[model samples]
Target chain A: MSLSARRIIPGLGLFVLMTVVAVWALWPTGGKVTINDRARDLAAELRCPDCEGLNVADSTTTSARSIRKDLLRRLKAGEDEAEIKNSYANRYGESILLNPDGGGLGILVWGLPVLLLVLGGVGITIAIMSRSRSTRLTPTESDREEVKKARGK
Target chain B: MKYSARWIALSVGAVVVGLGVVLAMQVGNDPRIDATKSQLVGQPAPELSLRALDGTAVDTNTLLGKAVIVNFWNSWCIPCRNELPALKEFANRYRDDPGVALVGIVRDDSTRAIKAYVKAEGIDWVIVTDPDSRAALDFATRGQPETFALDANGLITGAQIGPTTLRDLESLLGSAQGR
Candidate 1:
């Protein structure tokens, strides 16, 4: 009917659509550890010795597959994630873990993302403030009087 | 000249559209396991020297001239244990076949336990023990019950993780022979 109503209707529809999509994307797939999920998780943790910088989960190498199988077995046995990881660490050293543990140099890995987010927010705020200051009109009394005279005329 | 809000919105929309297109392309181009060629198909088999239960050595290099199937397994592994009967039978069936060799690599398990399991199962194939598991790492073995099919030239032709059927083994052997 009205131009504003038409614009509002589309914006509302878009908001609903976006909300639904986000929920669907973030919806829990039930258990945290299905057979495949555990396999994938293990794969992500275990480094593929054959493939540089790629975890077993991401690597298509034969070694990775075997590592995945091992991970699956460990998962099936009701072994906790920490124990499974420890097992790998025992055999292959700490480098086997894709993400380092949350201590020592590993702490930096986890902390950096948070630090970046905070810095980004601060940078954006500063940028907005700087831009507004540069573009803002500072009206003198003479300019205001001229504006008042123009309005009167 | 300064851009309008409309231009900024358009740029953001363009970026979102570009990201969506890239994601779609990636999903579309994702290869099925069968469609993807195995990288290990032609690579030299990883060298390993592990001792058999009888205190004898089973070396990959020594088996270079023969078509060998190196099966990594352990008694503690359920899948490995589950697949033992089928593997034993397969090994038996192919035992007389001079072109085929089945060697089992025991990973992260004690020699005594492996020997007991092999004896209980009556597994007649050559079983090797990787107590230190250095051989396992060398073979890039992730877990037990993984098999690598090696050609006569000691090049790995196929690798199967988890329990595989006899049919799977035959197909792998067929592929190795270029049949």
Candidate 2:
């Protein structure tokens, strides 16, 4: 194969891989009526209102059981996962969500660390480049001796 | 230039510490950072029709013209027990008030336990059971001892997430009235 073909083939493979991953993440598992897999996955994402820091799927509390039942009902009703999540969020304010919304203050909480990391990377890159350039212009021993004698060292 | 870089670092550190302190102060004042606040306030209360501990069906629609106090509690909850005396007193105070109704919802508990508690506590108000917790879920309760005050049109006027005193219940009930 030609060089360009070889490079393009790998690039195409990477693009296809990324597309599959993205689609997998956004795929709707909400309409699945199985009581265990999809329903339980969705339940696990919901906060158990009566239990402290426990997800609905994990809690044995009656309230959690009810919530799980409600979730299954909605799923069986053919509601989309996002729709079910939004329904709870609307009734409970955004705080009820185990995962915060992508908008508003949640964006800040999620974005700040990534922003700091990128900025730190740029700073480190600049520092390394400047240090390397200065080292490349290193003075000879004669030059150092001349400077030392001039300074009466 | 080196001194300036150090100064910038120091300033950034100071700002971070200052922000942390401000957040710390707020943490004490607002411990419900993870708790869901009432989104039902000012919204029409969801339909609640459940079997009372007395085996009678109690529905919110029948009490449409009356100010309603819907309290969600369970027999097992300590906070629910703690607020029972205040809740009882509030119920008695409003017992003669035909314009107001106080309804308590027992969550995730048996009728036998509730009946025993109600008799022992002398609770003379309407206490209902949320069999599947549909009403509690609709109300978006975080924990037990949550209370919601609704106006005559069945619109929620106020909501309390924790145990409330008689004064608070009175204020919540009063606000729902004449509105």
Candidate 3:
């Protein structure tokens, strides 16, 4: 094959491999279990105070540890998940939860990421198309002459 | 021009790979359980105001003249529940000592639950409630069953996180008494 094509092929392969690996490595495992089934279900919906990105069960923060203990206690006491979470929300406020109740600013935080991703994809597509159009050109006589000379050599 | 573009892409890929490796390392290093050793020793005791179970307000100011054992706990915490009996015994043993006072700070728990737990466990210390959890925030407490021994000057002489043994309690009390 041509030298330029050979060089480009390896780079493209590396790029694709890196993208796949990045997505795989960073995907959330959600190692959720049913220790206190009711509490686990509730905790799955609650955000961890120390590590806000994860649910309570998935977090290892001291606060999360305490919160999980409370959840289990409530569960064992025959309190349902909804009742327990509601009690916690009353005490600590709704921001303690991972999933915000529908409506208001909570919905906005949830929606913003998807909106940005769509906008970014559209912007990239337009930029790529515009760039390709601007850079494209018909081959000149000098280019053809060079190719012919090179082929002959 | 083509080769340069390829080189740029490859460099970017390398950087992304390096970043991923660093993040993975950090995640791997994350501690699974809370460390039992105290991080608050040598630091000044955090200011706190909590209402005793008897409905009297207790603050750091109240602890000024005496060395105090400030135990952060909650009725909902299992480890705290497990450690309460030992704490109760220790407080009882030191009850008559004017130089040493044992105080319990109920963290982020309901007053009703705390009262019930205290009653059931026969905990006789000055049990207090931090409904706002201001004390927890100030102490940077990650969970329940953390104990801090403060000198007469209100400086933290020693601290212990998680469940406390009778031996740990005695050593802390002994050190505070000695100071």
lDDT of each: 0.71, 0.80, 0.72
- C-alpha TM-score for every candidate: 0.55, 0.69, 0.51
Candidate 2 per-residue C-alpha lDDT over A61-149 given as tens digits, one digit per residue, 9 for 90 to 100 = 77788888888888888897899999987887666678867785456567666755665655555554455445345699999999999
- Report the backbone clash tally of model 3: 2
Residue B106 shift from truth in candidate 1, angstroms: 0.7
Candidate 1 to native Cα RMSD, angstroms: 14.0
Runs in model 3 with CA error above 4 Å? A1-153, B20-28, B31-39, B174-179
Cα RMSD to native, each candidate? 14.0, 8.1, 13.2
* Global local distance difference test of model 2: 0.80
> Model 2 segments beyond 4 Å from truth?
A1-36, A108-153, B1-36
The better-scoring model by DockQ among 2 and 3 is 2
Candidate 2 C-alpha error for residue B64, in Å? 0.4
lDDT of each residue in A102-150, candidate 3, tens digit only: 5654454566566556555555555544554465477899999999999
Best by DockQ: 2
Task: Give, for candidate 2 chain B, the lowest lDDT window spanning 10 residues.
Answer: B28-37
Per-residue lDDT of candidate 2, residues B109-161 (tens digit) = 78888889889888889988887778888888877889999999999999888
Count of backbone clashes for each model?
A: 3, 0, 2
